[model samples]
Target: MAKPIARKTSRGADRMETTLNNKVLTEIWGADQGVGLRVKQAALVVLGIAILAVAAKIKVPMWPVPITMGTFAVLSIGAAYGARLGLVTILGYMIVGAIGFDVFAGSSAEKFGLTYMMGGTGGYLVGYVLATFALGLLARRGWDRSFVWMALAMLIGNVLIYVPGLIWLGQLYGWDQPILQWGLTPFLIGDALKLVLAAVILPAVWSFVGKART
Candidate 1:
């Protein structure tokens, strides 16, 4: 009986290690072989939803405009959770916002829920999912392990976000309207700052984890 139990434990650890081969940052802490993937994902999704809400609501004062952490949170979560889990987490957060949770940066009690979702920010919301997916894919390819690759990945993700976002703005408003000014230009500086921050943070974390292991 003892030998069988030992073998089972070793097998489980082996399975977990195999699964974690292309691990994201979140798996670096609190992951256990005895725990199932579904359980870990469910918990991470919940925590991610909460983090999205808080990041959406908070604003840091900056020179051009107040910096909202919403996009940063979305990208980071995608990089940390990978593609499928990131999709689920972002979708869950969107659903919560759609149901009138005040989970969006521009939403208010007076104008919240699905109506708000269908407004100007609608395209950007769609972009969030696309960008998240792209980031997840890049992170899986080890882009998040180095500052240069991470920065490039972030630039690609931002482009994914802005493309649909600008198109949506054009369709919603008018083609002649200053869609660039309204939706893209003002945000570029802030996005650049965020890109640098993410580039520095993700690689530094990987370095820390590597050192700690040795």
Candidate 2:
């Protein structure tokens, strides 16, 4: 899994985790699945989900959609945690939201079931799962620490989200809605900015971790 390396400032719990994470970095990444986690591991998974949920609340209303730190949060978390944990964390968040916990962008799942999947933003939500997985791949390669790589990764992640989003939007709004009018017209600049933000943050995280190791 790829993610922004949270700066581990202390030497007890934080250092221990940092060290262990470093050691298992390869193993967690090498397998089709991630490295196995026991009880302690499960706890970390839940914690990651919580982190994303908290970030969601600190959002603004941006154009083309509700502006939120949710995507940035997920990308960073996925880059930090790797695929298995990243995926589990997001799914956990989704599961909680579906039960009507206000964890998603819009709050309320509207009955919360298969019906939600057929809704307007469902495809984008599904895309979150994918974006994180890809971020994990990059994180494993140690590109999580590289700015350029992170930018590219974030762009790809957004594209992955958008592809399904556009298709679903067309299905819902009809192809006559004018592609430029609803597809990417309002969000292109913002998407670029988000990509830049991810690039800056991911490398800073890598730098922080590298410095810590030293």
Candidate 3:
């Protein structure tokens, strides 16, 4: 009888731990609330897209590549919204940009739609979606629950953005262009700053959430 009771209690404790570990901030903020949740989620996605658009427009000019707040916004959205919603939000942003909306970084009246997407920055744009998805997966796994893990997750997402961006840039300009000088070296400091900022903000927000819940 004692052995059976002990085993049952252990199982119950394990389940409780799993439940606690799986609770992401998005769900904690009521994303799991049934019918109305869909509407709220849709709203969040739209908001995220808007944020990305705005971030894209804020650029620090550089040769070949410019620094933008877009990466920070992408990581934040992924951490705040979780995997499914983050993926949807990024995809929606890309769709809007592809359709000729002036939402992409440095987008102009002369450049819009699919034509603009296939431009030099196109690979980076696609990378945004992948990075968001990666970050969101980590967020779902509770990596966003603390500072260090969140920072590491965001850093990984940042690197994912660079990989495709560099490849596309290299393809476009060839070896003559010095791809590292154009694509990677210029943005390292900015990306590092963004990573630290995200790492601090997410854990701070989680702290607030914990207080609110209590």
User: lDDT scores for all predictions?
Assistant: 0.88, 0.70, 0.84
How does candidate 2 fare on TM-score? 0.74
Clashes of each: 0, 10, 1
Clashes of 2: 10
* Order of the predicted models by lDDT, top scorer first: 1, 3, 2
Model 2, residue pairs in steric clash: 1-82, 1-83, 1-136, 2-78, 2-79, 2-80, 2-136, 3-79, 3-80, 62-67
Worst 10 residues of 3 by lDDT: 16-25
Give me the overall lDDT of model 3: 0.84
Off by over 4 Å in 1: 1-21, 31-35
At residue 168, give the lDDT of candidate 1: 90
What are the per-residue Cα lDDT tens digits for candidate 2 across 1-214?
1232333434455665554444323233323334444554677678877887787676656766656677788787777777877888888888877765766655554544445655777777878888888888777766666788888888888887778878878888888887556656776766777778878986786566556755
Candidate that would win on TM-score: 1
Which whole-number lDDT from 0 to 100 does residue 53 have in model 1?
A: 96
The digit string of per-residue lDDT tens for model 3 on 110-185 reads 9888998897888888788888889888988888878799889988997888899989988988867888887788
Q: In model 2, how large is the Cα lDDT of residue 3?
A: 32
